[model samples]
Target: MWQNEPPVAGDLPAEQGIPTLITWNHGGNVVAVEGSWDSWTSRKMLQRSGKDHSILLVLPSGIYHYKFIVDGVQRYIPSRSSFCS
Candidate 1:
């Protein structure tokens, strides 16, 4: 359930960016996400909830590539199955 249409005026503040939720279900004691959004320089840590780890990112509309660092190892998602919109 996601909407591509532009938000109506007043729906959100002009300074706010899109709210994107990133989730990882694979097991790990520590999980983090690094993406092109920050040039892969900032590793944002995800909060663990039950069996999953997730982080909410507020980003501008654009394309980005990301990888998950689970317990100090990097994991990549193949481009063929990646979501781009």
Candidate 2:
């Protein structure tokens, strides 16, 4: 089984101009971020970092909703955001 630190709950405050790193530990072949940051039109592939998966996104300061797509199935990270059907 793959083990990784999940995304922090609530709003994520920006630091400098660096992108925010979001992670998931589903142990899937592919993982991607789908959200308002990209207008929900594309999937930003998350790289496999050790036993976890992560993506770097530089988004504007705002409440942008998002979810993860693991191997073509959508999944939600609890306490982070509601599941988008």
Candidate 3:
């Protein structure tokens, strides 16, 4: 599940700005959200949930590109439009 909006009442604090929660349910040992936010160099490690991995990011209002890195492998979600080069 990929949420670009902040949750009403949940684990994320309301004062932490807009929260974008990215989650992945897989058997990998590690997962991350890598994109232009970090120059596509570093990986923001996601926290482990019950049977999934997730990460909460506070981002400004705008559009951004990103992909998931699971166990050192990069995977991109297919977009309807040509957003990726």
The candidate that wins on TM-score is 1
Error of 3 at 71 (Å): 0.8
Regions of candidate 3 where Cα sits further than 4 Å from its true position = 1-17, 79-85
Per-residue lDDT over 1-85 for candidate 3, one digit per residue giving the tens place of the 0 to 100 score: 9889866577665563457776777557788878776577878998987779988788655566888888899866565111222
lDDT of 1 at 80: 28
Q: Worst lDDT window (10 residues) for model 3?
A: 76-85
Off by over 4 Å in 1: 1-15, 79-85
lDDT, model 2: 0.77
TM-score of each: 0.74, 0.68, 0.63
How high is the CA lDDT of each candidate model?
0.83, 0.77, 0.71
TM-score, candidate 2, is 0.68
Q: Candidate 3: global Cα-lDDT?
A: 0.71
Candidate with better TM-score, 1 vs 3 = 1
lDDT of 1 by residue, 1-85 (tens): 9879998888876765678888888799899989888787899999999989999999877777888999999986564223443
Better lDDT candidate (2, 3): 2
- Tell me how far the alpha carbon of residue 43 in candidate 1 is from the true structure, in angstroms, after superposition: 0.5
